[model samples]
Target: MKKLTSIIAIATSMATAEVANAQSQYYKKAEQNPYTLVYDGAITKNEKGKVNIHPVKYKLNGIEIAANVYTPANYDASKNYPAVAVAHPNGGIKEQTAGLYAQRLAEAGYITIAADAAYQGASGGEPRHTDKPQFRTEDIRGMADYITQYPGVDAKRLGVLGICGGGGYTLKAAQGDKRFKAVATLSMFNSGEVRRNGFQNSQLNTVQDRLKQASDARAQEAAGGEVKFSGVANITDEEIAKTSTDLYREGYEYYYRTHAHPNSTFLYTTSSLLDLMTWDAAEHMDLIEQPLLMMAGSKSDTKYMTDEAFPKAIHAKNKELFLIDGATHIQTYWKPEYVVQAVNKLVSFYKTNL
Candidate 1:
């Protein structure tokens, strides 16, 4: 009787542990499906174009992030092709700048996948726009996994390109992950440094201001609602400083209006500011073994990030930094001339490296 009682207790304990594990897994899946934004309609590929666009879904950090695959015109399922994964800027969608870059790269004879980061755009995640650096970095790695397994994609020749904040994440991914043979960034924002210190370290000089802002944000969050975020919306004459070294106003105009999508907005959580404070994408630049390319608009305020990050890359014997004189940060997003220049550079870089 004593032996039977002991056996029954052990069995019950084991069953309880299994039940707990199952619940944990279920909650994780729930976290991944916290939210989603569906596109009103599909974006069709141009018949005359050499690229075909297809919607795809993949899990990143357990979240089901959505992406679009652009296959070269002559894509043969039996023949593997080098793949490029494009990451979009902060608060931007896959359909914005990243999509354009991916499509162009695909047209240039590469398989490209442009993805919406977790918690933003059409991707799935809780709290809507939480910007976690580690998670964002994981998103890129997840894309590499998705593409390598994809039909017609040559895993060994995988490449990554990131625009704006996406660029920062790409750098982080390349530094940590060996899957990406080549990595590149356009107008990369050192999110962690920028968050801790304002653009150009202007705001970081004093800790009091940052503390106060964080305190207020926490209070707002505790009040049972989402925290609000602020950023450049529509550009105005008054917003442009007379002695400003960068063409920030013009850049905002290009991104916020000319090429803006209804689903894309600059709103993020005030809590995200805290995350950015510690998020440094170029922390281990010297460790990345892959080829690196950093491109920036000489006239943009965000040029400092690219400038600082490029010189620190140690393992990359092959690295290039191209500065476009007349372009501003936003102009590089979708301006006809600047976009053409960027796409050309990207295609050239990937072709040479891959």
Candidate 2:
């Protein structure tokens, strides 16, 4: 018995040391990439008398939202300027692609804001990572409310750009929120369609079973039991290398490897699935009467989602779907050449519409 106890103690100490080492590694990397902003053109802090990044905090639906607002070069509060709101992707914060786009737009002379989702990132919310369709849509609307009131902003010329899951929610928000004079989506991802039907319908037969699991998770949370989390908690290098789909394989690489951000995570409460599985990105597409542009990678496995949603927006005043050649969904977020191409198209789209 004494020998067994000693062996267990040794094993426990080794495990504890390993965990401590992993944390130290994360913190060390974090110092090099503090703020977790990994985009090519990301800013470390706000600069004076130039295109600058302004960290913002505001209340939306009673939750304090964390965001970054980019002001145009030589900004003058006395003069009116056009504004745009850039929404981040799933498991994304303002510091990633959204901030990259926002900063690029600012250089193009448009004030822009990129915010973290309420229950995610640096934003304030209970039961962290509770992603619901309603809350996501509301977040887009909240950006409009705050930016329109910002000094030098012209509410009449406001526009919105949603990326990935943000793109999906933007479609829902723009369907009713006419305040957004122009709408654009980059690498659009339909959270609802994928959740309910599964990716490429690969898990169609297990829908009910997965749903029951979500329901049970919700019940447990309501009863004040142990909190349950879902989604990708951790992954091995070998597993990512062997992933079949480009959308996810490259995605795991982007979100967990090359451009990994400490604030970005793959987990969400299991109960969130209850709401996510029932929503559809294109349910009310007819209401978006504003000018619209949807861009995605032609080769993306998730391109089907954009293809499916774009055509349904027939009521939009002006709508165009452009597919990037030779790029994948995750590539559009960080690839220098692809990002430049997207920003150029966006500048043209916004200039013509806003």
Candidate 3:
């Protein structure tokens, strides 16, 4: 009787532990937000390019961000393979452009991961949609660490790709994290520069204007209100043409209409503008000694990022730049031709380097 009681007690404890692990492995509600989004898509499972999408969740800065893992067709747990960590743009999710890139890369024989950044998508963060540069950089590092431990992944053979704001974050990650054998970015945006000065330095050029906006934003926040932030979300057709900022129209078509997901929120705090002004990925670009591939549309208004950072990378020996002549910033996100070019370039770079 005593032996049986002890055995039952141990079994009960083990069951309890498993239940606790399952609950904690997934994200929990932070503050008042209790809902979460799960990507129920398929992933490749067969040699015919069948997909068997798997849910991947990992914690960064104490926030659990959701991710989708695409295992290549004919993926075998017995055989190890190289992997890529993909980061999406600000106000973007894994299902958008990142998913497209991840899928293509996986199809090309690499394990690819597309994750929702902190405070966005199915990721966990309080005060949603708050974009912090440091946290974003940490998110990439966290993904690299997670992928390294996967059953069939070769930790040493890893690379990273970031899109838009994610591109900037990837550059930042490469500067500090040596785990990534190579790094790449597409249509990168220096969020800090653009936030402080506006597009092409059109606004906040003067210290007075910058201070005025800061002061007003603080006052608004102090009055039990959120400061209004602006971007592609606030622009209209007339505004896009008036600015003549290259690729503004393409941005509108992606973020506002066709590819827009119902849960993707665009509102951000105006106070974050002050934080963005100080964010610069190029600050330590020279420190990154790994192979770097930077891609941007030749006519993209955001082309300046590629132009500036690419020239400043002094430590990189194997660096290349591809500027798509007819492509715009948003065009490369989903356009078949541009996507293929970007994915092909990424696969070639990783295969050779990693």
Best by lDDT: 2
- Candidate 2 wrong stretches, greater than 4 Å: 1-30, 33-35
The digit string of per-residue lDDT tens for model 2 on 129-209 reads 889999999999999999999999999999999999999999999999999999999998898877777788766766787
> How would you order the candidates by lDDT, starting with the best?
2, 1, 3
The candidate, 1 or 2, that scores higher on lDDT is 2
lDDT of 1 by residue, 1-354 (tens): 112111001122122443334334433422442122112122343454456787889777678989988899877879989999998887788877787788788879999998888888788997777787877888888889899998999899999999998999999899879889989899898878876766677665554455466567768888986665544323333333332534344544333434445446555665666677766877888988898889998777888899889988977957999987688888788677888888888888898899
User: Would you estimate the TM-scores of all the predictions?
Assistant: 0.81, 0.92, 0.81
Candidate 1 RMSD to the real structure: 15.1
Pairs with steric clashes in candidate 1: 192-279
Better of 1 and 2 by TM-score: 2
Model 3 clashing residue pairs (backbone)? 42-53, 43-51, 43-52, 43-53, 44-50, 44-51, 44-52, 45-50, 192-276
TM-score of 2: 0.92
- Which sequence of candidate numbers ranks them by TM-score, best first? 2, 3, 1
Question: C-alpha displacement of 300 in model 2, angstroms?
Answer: 1.1
Q: What ranges in model 3 sit over 4 Å off?
A: 1-49, 204-208, 215-229, 232-243
Residue 259, model 2: lDDT of 64
C-alpha-based local distance difference test score of model 1: 0.73
